[model samples]
Target: MGERIASWFAAGHRPLPWRAPDFPAWGVLVSEFMLQQTPVARVIPRLEEWLARWPTPADLAAVPPGEAVRAWDRLGYPRRALNLHAASVAITERHGGIVPSDVDELLALPGVGPYTARAVAAFAYGSRVPVVDVNVRRVLARAVRGVGEPGPARTNEEHALTEALLPADPARARLTNAGTMELGQTVCTARAPRCDSCPIADACAWRAAGYPAYTGPAAPRQKPYAGSDREVRGRILRELRANELPVPRDRIAQLWTDADQLERALRGLVADGLVEIGDGGFRLPMH
Candidate 1:
């Protein structure tokens, strides 16, 4: 099954920039940060622009962190930009501007968590580590566990299951890692999986079990954006991004009608270190 999935991905995976043969590890790190919660289509252009402007960790580390936030440009979860910037600074200062391949070293960097650490080690350095994203988890649940959906994340178990499926050879293990993710992203999608087109369909336990409906605790759903504090935050950000100088407090207040919601968003942004209040007014942090 692993072999089949690797073969399937090798034959037809999308030509994303980070997947290119000559792509730098720095590019992979940037892509992983930008791709969080953002769709691939939106990430491609932003990734390209980010790499073009700051080709190395040292380059990004040279600039103000606010530049990174400004470059984030509606990616949502603006804090990831700060994390990426801080990580770049750490890499430049501690690792001689090189993205670390060791999972421990990667995890120590700002914004690099378990999944991200493994992903960079596997995908960027071909380190033979299991890289399970949401997509890969879905693939595992159906193909091996005979379930329609994975239950709430149990990190250790996910790694163990993915590791058990990996090939013995390092190169083959890398292929399996990439292929499983591709299979999940393209074929074994969360909604409306294409069982007929899946390369591992013959071996899929879920197919053999007649695709039972998932009865596990449901994945948490995102709240609606309309009239939410997030909407207020975005409006405030847009206003700040549009202006070179700090937006006046009154002008910032005019963007959202709900004063309480706007205040909450502003306070949240400041608390998150994404925004700052000063004598001039409210603005993106620039130190």
Candidate 2:
């Protein structure tokens, strides 16, 4: 399984900046952070700009949190900006300004979860660990388990399957990790899987099982972005990001008619520490 996927990865896979030969660990860490719930195309340009501006953990840590929020722009989840900034500060202070390659140490950093920690270890440090993203889970489900979708992550079960497939050689294992994720994103897609293009299609369990419909317990679908608190939050963040000066209460209210929702968004941002409530009204965190 690892060999086939590794070969498929080497034959294709887009030339992302983080995938470059000897790309810095810091760059890999940032790429993983920015890639969370965000598309690769949108993340690429922003990732480049971010790395160029603050090439290291110390460089990013030196800037105010507000600057991080401002640079985050319309990334949807602005809290990630605050979390990334906090993580940089942690990396700088605790690890002497280096992104830790050890999974446990990586997980210690703010905003670093199990997946992100494992990713940094594998991709940055060449650790022989399973890097299972949503894509990998889907691929595993259909190709090996004969299921259309992986359904709400059963971490231990999924991790065991991926770990079982890992190559003994760390380098080969790393290649498999990248390959499986690529296959999931490009070939074994959630909506329209391209079975013909998949290298493992011939042996795919789901195909052999006649492509049964997914009827088991599934992950809940995401709520629509429009008119939700998320949309309101984005609007508020957009208003704040556009202005060098702090936006006043009434000025922001003008952007959205739902006064209650507007207040809720502002309060949410402040509570999340992404926004600061001050005499100047609401603004991205300055301290």
TM-score of each: 0.97, 0.98
Return the clash pairs for model 2, or none: none
Tens-digit lDDT track of model 2 for 58-164: 99999999999999878768888899999999999999998998999998999998899999999999999988899999999999899999989888888888988
Report the alpha-carbon TM-score of model 1 versus the true structure: 0.97
Candidate 2, number of clashes: 0
Candidate 2 off by > 4 Å: none
State which candidate has the highest lDDT: 2
Q: Model 1, range 1-287, lDDT digits (tens) per residue?
A: 87787788778788888777578999999999987789999999999999999999999999988789889989988889999999999999999999999999999999998988998888889898888889989999999899999877878889999998888877778788888988888889988899889899999999999999889897778899888888888888878777768888999989888888889999999999888887688888787
Q: Per-model C-alpha lDDT, please?
A: 0.88, 0.90
lDDT agreement of model 2 with the native: 0.90
Model 2: ten consecutive residues of lowest lDDT: 12-21
